[model samples]
Target: MGIPGGSAPSTRLLLLPGTLGAGLIGLSLWLGLSHGTPLRCFSGVAVGLCFVSAGIAAWRLRPRSRTGPWMALLGLVVLTSHLNDGLMLPTSMSGRELITLFGTPANWLQVPVAELLFLAYPSGRLRTTAERRLVTGAFALGAVAAMVMLATKTPVPICGGWCGPSPLQLVADPQLYLRLRSVFMTGTVVLAAAALALLIRRGIRSTPRQRRLLRLITLAAGLTVLLFAATQLFIVAVYTGRTGITPTVFLFETLTSWLAAITLPLAFLAGLLRQRLAFASVGTLVGRLEHVAANTVEAALAETLRDPTLRVAFPTEQGWIDVSGHLFHPPSDGSQLLTPLGDPPVAVLVHDPSLSEDRQLLDAAATAVRLSLENARLHAQVQAQLTEVRASRQRIATAADTERQRLERDLHDGAQQRLLGIGLTLGLLRNRVRGTTGRRLVDELERELCTAIGELRDLAHGIRPAVLTDQGLAPALAGLARRSGICVHLDVQVTERLDPLVEITAYYVVSEALQNIVKHADRADACVRAVHRAGWLVVEISDEGPGGATTASSSGLSGLADRVTAVGGQLQITSPPCGGTHLRAELPCA
Candidate 1:
């Protein structure tokens, strides 16, 4: 059956030669063993081995198989043929005896068939398409020659009817037959030589080791073909009656055949060894480079992570380094913090089984990064706690101010009103009694009540502004400006209303700054401007006064700054060389 799934054309072509070679070997073995020809038996064994080798090489497609087995089989055939001739089996055996035992119809067919089959094996290994076609054409021509010779010639009986010599020998004259055989042998030799030359040229252009192996194989193939040609020439010479076959020629053929057989296998083994060595060396080098690259990357990552303000990153396609992880620094205002290893930034995010996670001397930098991050987290938490505490204190201060305002209102409405009413009643009684002493006592009482009322009003104003609750921050600031006597210029531009607490806070800030200017600045004129800009209420107060004013030197201004800071607002004081004090406060409006 054909190979399954329709084998490659090359494989199909190779199979034909292999099958024919096997059939030849089987026939040769049967004839040699049955007829008791030791020379034939040995030739059969060698041919069998060659078939096996060629079959294996065809399957493997290894370079060495081209010459190795063919040379071996050719050597065995030459030796066996010569030995058979020397032994004179045909001359010694009686016709009846040879026919009954040694000579058989099968034996007659085996010899030429084996030789033809052997010739076809090398065709499969031809290098180029041209070479392959040439070799195939030669084999076809040889087959045609054999067929024509068989058709024209009559069979000549050798040892009775059991076996015979080639019919061509009987029909054609010896000279003409020898010339035909010489042409056949020469053509085959030339084809083989051409193939060998192509292989050698290919090898020469290859790597040094491969070239050496190929050259050796080519040499073996060439020598085998040369020896075969010499044997054919010697036979042709004998047929032509020029000279008898010489022992020296036979010896040379035998030696060269053996040499070809041994060299072929050696060449193949050498090439295999060279290929394995080269690949193994390459694998070792790649492994080392990979290890070095991994180590270098790890070290770099560790170094970057160890620094507080530094971050580790990976190169992007646009040649920018993207942050992969960071240590010690707070998250940037506009920029984001690096998360845990993901994507390109951290190349080796997955944990490797070979690597240790435990803290060690070699991993000190990585360990340091972990510690610093933890410390930074704890510091942030502590700051949050302090902020909460400050907020609690401010809440308490506001509550105390509310209580003071209530107390002041109670005194003004109850005790101070009651005293004024009593003084008025006393004045009316004295007028009814018509006494100067009573009137004088009533007037003194009235005067004391007035003083008490004035002190209570001052206390209420100090506790909290009635003006801030009655109107918005702008009107209160305007009232302050009107009262300041320092030519206070008010510019309030806040349109959207704010939280009561924020409005009060802004009012207080402006009031404190104006008071500072009046007390310390000694300025002739001052400007108070409050504008809402970029989600902040920006208040700027400037006075043309003697400079050199500082928050540290003035407790009130310093306290005002602290209060503003507590609410996440900034207060700046600038006293310039021109004897002007400028105070700027920015408070978040929302």
Candidate 2:
């Protein structure tokens, strides 16, 4: 298979092999008919058709592949060998002369073809320099041996089968060249055997992709090798002048040769057709347009190209995006292929560069999902924008939380302490100012100072809530329940400390939900329930009052939604008309 489909030669050159095969077949059949042997005639036609069909199939499958020509050569050469075999039973003096002239020369056809089949089996070339050189030398040597046989007009001895006489001698000393025939035949057979073995070994060590291509061809080639081995054994027997191995073995070997010959070409043709199977999904893909997914084009392209690693990138305003709507980029390296979708190219598929030659499949894949791909592209753009917005909101929330914590700390350690000191000073001065006229004024001023301090402490607590930091979520939640206006039934089922952010999110969800309930639920009664279950922190704040709570524009619930979203948590409010609001929030802790 030395590059089964090589650089395509001239059109005529490509068609020549098929033409030669047809002529050879027709000639062989005519000769068989003249000889009046129906079995021989049918055998010739069948073998001829096998090789010719294989050549045509390979050529059509991959016109540029040299394997097709090699396949054709295989068929044509087999025809030569078969014709030589048939010519032994001559119908004319000319036929006898042709047998004498062409018999041994035609037999040598198998030698180089066998080695060629081994070295370049299905769709590959001779892998190693040494094997290539050996096969070339065998061909050259076989040609020289044929030249010698023709020059001396020497008749090769029958191994196990009969050979007609060669009365026409071009040279006086035919025996001189005849001695060298056995030596050349043996060398050629040995080389063929070595080449075949090496081919098998290479196949065993080849890449899985290459081996997959070998599935059919390997079986056919293996049988052909066995046939050759049997022929070699027959030659060895004849050399020693022993009656060949049992008649059953000889018969089986000969019949096996015919079977192997028939199967090999057909197997190669099958191998060639396998490449086309990659495009079989074209119809299925086109049909899938009715129900195209975001990855329908990509998935279809990947399968059709037989490249599971195939990627489909949709070009966007923000560069490129993947199916998941994540920001993506075409490969910076030249290894990737960028195929734009339409004229105003909404998307481009980044794929392996090796698949560029498979233009038909790629084009079909791109076209198949153009509509869905555009929609998916738009969806991906929206996703990317959402991703950026979410990130921005998360940053804002984090900064807000940091500021709130700073304010809480300042109130607890700085302002709260100073206020306590002023109140203490007022208490100390109260006894001194007890009898003065200014004492009444001092007492009222002290009372106002205490109220101001109380309000300031409440303001700081509202900002960050010191309890949330000093204590944990459940206790802070319990404190919130105690402080709430309405009667709150608090149920805490947390057995483990949740992630800090998750706990914070859950705290805020409950805090805001309850506050909403107090403000808008026309609060008759309220329930604050927080629990840790199944890898999530679940917080529920339900109120038994008029519900109808909509997450109104920039309202309390909307702010809570942003906070919940920032922490990858969810806030769900189930408020029926004039019934009650059941606010549920879930935060993933693990």
lDDT of 1 by residue, 1-590 (tens): 21111122365655555565555455556545655465645643563454345444533443223443343343334333323332234433344233322222222222332333233333224444655565566556556555544433322222233223442334544345455655655565565556555555655654442344456666666676667667666755664567775776656555554554455445545544544453344344434434433223333433332212233333323232323222224344522233333233332111211112111211333333333333333444454456557667667656755676577678767876886787678677767865788777767877887787778666666556677667777887888788776788889997767755566668777778788777876746888898987789888888888877778888887987877776667899998666788888888766
Error of 1 at 272 (Å): 36
Off by over 4 Å in 1: 1-369, 411-433
Give the RMSD in angstroms, all C-alphas superposed, for model 2: 7.4
- RMSD each, Å: 24.8, 7.4
* Lowest summed lDDT window (length 10), candidate 1: 350-359
Pick by lDDT: which candidate is best?
2
The Cα local distance difference test for each model comes to 0.52, 0.69
lDDT of 2 by residue, 295-366 (tens): 455676677666666776666666777876787866686646787767877777777654554465667667
